[model samples]
Target chain A: MATTTTPAATPGRTKGTGKPAGPPGRRPRRSLLPYLLLAPAVVLELAIHVIPMLVGAWMSLLELTQFHIRDWSGAPFVGLDNYRVVLDVNSAAGAELLRSFRVTVIYTVLSVGLSWVLGTTAAVLLQRPFRGRAVLRALFLTPYALPVYTAVITWTFLFQRDTGLVNHVLVDQLNLLDDRPFWLIGDNSFVALLIVSIWRTWPFAFLCIMAGLQNIPDELYEAAAMDGAGFWRRLRAVTLPMLRPVNLVLLLVLFLWTFNDFNTPYVLFGGSAPAEADLISLHIYRSSFQTWDFGTGSAMSVALLLFLLLVTAGYLLLTNRRRNDA
Target chain B: MRETATERWTRRIVLTLLAGFVLVPLYVMVSSAIKPLQDVQAAFTWWPRRPTLQAFVDMWSTVPLGRYLINSLLVASVAAIFSVAVAIFAAYAVSRYRFRGRQVFSVTVLSTQMFPGILFLLPLFLIYVNLGNATGIALYASRTGLIITYLTFSLPFSIWMLVGYFDSIPRGLDEAAQVDGAGPLRTLFQVVLPAAVPGVVAVTVYAFMTAWGEVLFASVLTNENSRTLAVGLQGYSTQFNVYWNQVMAASLVVSVPVVAGFLALQRYFVAGLTAGAVK
Candidate 1:
């Protein structure tokens, strides 16, 4: 995993080059070029990611609000106060944050789970060549290909109560429900958000899993079949095991992307998501931008970042350990 | 391992179901765009009753769609081009050279992908404001600011993927070029780049699509004049009503370039994206 993830860490292998290594100081002039080439990316990464992260951590300690925004440095220091307010479950802000956190957890889990399942299902089913398979594969990837805003905005329209196709199918056609529930607002907004999220993300899972499927040689399946392993048994023994590495990375990527997703909820529900469907990203956005409480917002943002870092670290560690065990 | 009739039917059924799920929103968008405003505002219809292209015409005038489009194009294009250029150099260095801090650089860039954009939003906003005040260069509510902010969003992935892509091009090529007195820069541009064009295109499309679809930053960063389509498209729905037809029309228009580009380069994009995970 480390070797694959870090391309630079792997020593370059020169093909057909029998030449011995040059003297250590032979290429002094060329040494500077790498640094020169790297300077722009390094500088931009610092400005865009590193510096702002440090500043964000700093801002988390200050009572930065609309009042102090113009001259944020002058904002009074309030170390841990923002964190306390947001993390204390008894407090309104904290309670709301907790609710949003729970919602996000549920949303991420369900979205990731459903997307992976759908993606794997579609990929496995379409693994073998069939009629119109090319068209179907291309069609399946359309959602992922479409811009996030365009796709979600279209969803917002589809989720509309009075004129929505979702309700029309469920109520008018399928007779699954008597009432045409308000999808973009109230409690159902969460469900609406989840649907759009699954719709948007499942295609990516499909693509990744499909690519992974190609790497699994047919001999594995043929061997499984020689052992009298049926379709379900063959899939379990051959397909899933071979796809483990891809799944490990795919699941983690999906988890991170879906967990931190802001676009789908923000666009589907507009800027201010309903409490029932408030993701932490939008919650933090509303905390700072809407309420002008940059301090608390930054605190929440820092917390979210820390939580994600922990999850990613834990995920990588666990996967690496499991791989070692295998 | 030949599938039985039952298995064949099951595959077809599942595929059809999944395809419907995938196509419904797209079908709705295309069908709704042609519907009359009243028809779209009323009960949903499987097909448009009164088909018209009025929404397509009205979309441009409804908001400053043209201005927003231009802003999106400029921001996304410049960001993509700059990101690709910077990434090519950095990727080359990382791929070909094992200098000090290379691992740290690669890891730092890769780890940035794990951080949420919201984490940067508040502080970046403040930095822009404070920097603007102190340095007399406006970053808040400015296109320049947005572009600068958006650079890192795709930089890490671009670098990571390009490194993988560049790693595939044999070192023999670079060694041969170097032996012939071609410098690293000349080898990269003339030798490696031509071979890595597909990877560059994939990265460009990814970066462009990212910038195009970005909502969180553009929401906070850009004002009306500088608003990209991601934020500006919300104008279609004011306090009074939502122009659903026109919104759909505009969505189709906005999505065409990206969707088409993505599908066209689907093979390379998939290969580049999955290289890290699969390998």
Candidate 2:
């Protein structure tokens, strides 16, 4: 193999990987090429996402109350006061924030768990090829493909207490309830939000798990079958073990999405989410925009970010350890 | 192996029921959108009996539906193009060169996904206000501003998807390009990118679809002149009296492009998704 050295290629990287040839025609000085190529993306990410995140942490320290919002620099610097406000369990607002956080945790668990169960069941069922399977796959994925606002908006109408199809079927058709339960209000609002969340997300799980399922070798199943293993046994022994990597990634992603989700609940519940179904995301949004308390909102958000980062890091460490053990 | 009749029947029955569960809300959406107000609230009819375009017409008359669509399309399209363009360079560098901080860079990109968009909103809002005050660039209430925000949210995922895609393209192509005297940039454009067409389409669709449907930022960031379809649709609900037919109709209208795009580019989309995660 004729090895053509890349002018700006890393000193130690171009060895032993059996990589292909470098592209032709290098500028005489190519040491800066990679940086040049990467600059725009790096700048944008830092400016928009990274820097703003740090700035949010700083703003969380300042008392960016409603009046000072126009001129945020003039906002009083009250170090950790906003965080104290959120964490102060004795205070009503603090208690409410804690309650919303609990609701968010429950929401995330139910939403992720149900979506994963449904998605996995569907993926495994559809793994065995059959006629019209392609159409069925497409049908299953339709919810995920549709716009979030549109899908959730439809769910809002569907969950309306008076005219909703959900109550019509559950109450009128099935006689499951004595009355049309208030789905879009009261404690049932959580159920309503969960239904919309699960509907929108499961299809993604299905798609990912299906892709994972395709990678498993049929021989493993056949071998298990020959050993007198039943379907469940075969799945446990062959499919589940084989799919651990995909499942870990899928579950983590699903958790992250469900935890951070703002759109579904926002659209479903409108601005002021029912106290029972008030998710932390909506709660934070209300704190900042609706109530014009940016400092407290930023503090809650910072708390949320730190919690998520811890979970993510822990998840990664657990998965990496498992991989090494395997 | 021969299939058993019982097994086949069971699979069919289960699939059909699941499909119904999946399709019912979509059915309700379409069925309610075309139905008149009387039909919508009258009873639980699965299909519209007296289907009319009146709801669509009413929605258009009441709201700037056309302008909302145009604005959304413009924002989504530009956001997708810019995000994908910037992502290509980063993805290419990561895929082709094993430089210092490469792993850190890739990990950072993945970590960005963990930070919720709301985390950026307040500070970005403040920055926008401050920057606009200092230098009159109108970053808060403009389509350009909204697009930039979308780009921020979309870039990490796009770059992640593209990196996976570029990794899949054989290193031999670059080798061949080098032999032919093409530079890294040319090889990426001429050899690697064309070969990774599915990834490009997937990234484009992903970014476009995200920007198209994004609501939280759009609701807070854009003004009436620059309001997107998502924000515009919210108007129907915020009013004292929500017109169910109009909301349904408007929801359908907003969904058409995203659904159509997903269907048209599904293969690439699936490939991108699966590749990004599973690998």
Candidate 3:
């Protein structure tokens, strides 16, 4: 793993030929040149991003309710009926589709906010040099690195009704509960997903925050400390404002990523009786694959895309405004 | 910088407790994997009564654990190799270039990261289905298709992160090379990249881990044939009776190597993480 990376990065570290491209025409060249430079990434995004979305948009308009497409000509062009079926509470699909959207919103907000605070706290505390910090830092990232399925499975096992470790400790050792607490399988799907999701996502927040914290020069704090200000004051006065941009970006990313995440809720609840727990992602999975309703599934996906596109546009606008203000 | 006694104490206590909190789930995974089935059935123990490798043995016998491990390793390694190579060039282009639409491109790239993978699923699945039908050369329901999908997720962040590292590299080095008659290409390769070794290592460990641990598309796109470790473990739920010990053992197999990877790539991983190597 270590070796594979070095060769790509070690391209031109040797002695150089000295005929420089002068600064004269550099300004004009740079204007068009950077666009050329970013051409590959734009092209890749077009392939991965624009094309699939266009395909989905087009597909959503077609009436292909079943899995296998047969009689395409006979299939009516039912424009937005699929969407109305999805949104109308009277319809079979609307109830679950709307439920999923509500749950997704709540889950995304809570998960992202909690993860950010925890991440920010950890990053702040671990910012300065300390003994055993290196090892602790690695441990901090463990949950994020533990793939979703593995973490979910482990969490489910720990939360099991009778023979789970959490129950043993909470009930047997400390007598925290009279009976085994229903952690994963209970009335509150919201609580269960929140616990596991927060635990798993904090590492991402940690990475973003710690990275930002490191870049904050020690001298800023030194100057503050010399003035006899406490840690909280310094953090509030200095750290928070400086980290605003990175935090915004991180928060935006987390909300979208966690919102789209399909597997976490699926692994925990398995589209079971408590339909309130179903997220939009899981709804898409079940609609398209399990129930074999591709048209409605494709419509839900288009809705998701619009919501995301709007969020991205808002975030970009805010960040760009901040950049301009700065 | 200054710490009060209360501050010091709270920090120490929270650190210790949080560390313990983090270790509990992992400890449960390890202990349950080693516990005997009868012991497991009776109750959860902080330490099992008679720890045995019975669960591991059973897990190996029952599921195709070895196949899943090999399949996951192959896909992750290949993706890491190809994606990092591509990420370096792509990151280079984004970071160094000062052209028109640069901001739009950067925003677009970041925006793609925000694009929900869920929305793309049905469309990508349909495309894969068509691929399988039209050409016998379909990458669908296989490692190849999965790798391509994983790369789409991996590439945006990798490029963004590489751009971050590129920004930190002093333009002086590149300019010095240019002054000494090197082209922009040579300058980027010779000067900019080697200085960013830590960043590259960071990207590798990150991309590898992302592929290694994700279950969303892995479970959806491929069925039983090319199942990865995460999907392999999910199979334990199929039987009406939950195989607690075996399932725990299977999870252990997945977590151990990744935890080991985290341990092995410590400084580079942590540094790169801060430097935007992983996200």
What DockQ, on C-alphas, does every prediction get? 0.53, 0.51, 0.50
Sorted on lDDT, highest at the top, how do the candidates line up? 1, 2, 3
Tens digits of lDDT, candidate 2, A1-326: 45343443442233122444343333333455677778898899889889999999998999888889888879999999999989898887799989998999999999999999889888888988777888888888889878888898889889888788998899888899997889888989998999889999999999888888877888888788778886577778988898888899889989988898889888898767898888888889877887888999999999999999899889889889988998
Task: State the fnat of candidate 1 relative to the true structure.
Answer: 0.69
Candidate topping DockQ: 1
**Which residue pairs clash in candidate 1?**
none
Task: Name the weakest run of 10 consecutive residues (lDDT summed) in model 1 chain B.
Answer: B175-184
Name the runs in model 3 displaced over 4 angstroms: A1-44, A67-75, A270-273, A315-326, B175-188, B263-279
Q: Which has the better TM-score: candidate 1, or candidate 3?
A: 1
Worst 10 residues of 2 chain A by lDDT: A11-20
TM-score of chain B of 1: 0.97
Listed for each candidate, the true contacts retained, as a fraction, are: 0.69, 0.57, 0.54
Instruction: Please report how far candidate 1 places residue B27 from its true position, in Å.
Output: 0.5
lDDT minimum window of 10 residues, candidate 3 chain B: B270-279
Check candidate 2 and list the clashing pairs: A21-B175, A24-B181, A24-B182, A24-B183, A25-B181, A25-B182
Flag the better candidate by lDDT, 2 or 3. Answer: 2
TM-score attained by model 3: 0.88
Model 3 Cα lDDT, one tens digit per residue, A19-95: 33444213224344445445655666776677777877877887866734543335567898889888898787888
> Model 3: which docking level applies?
medium
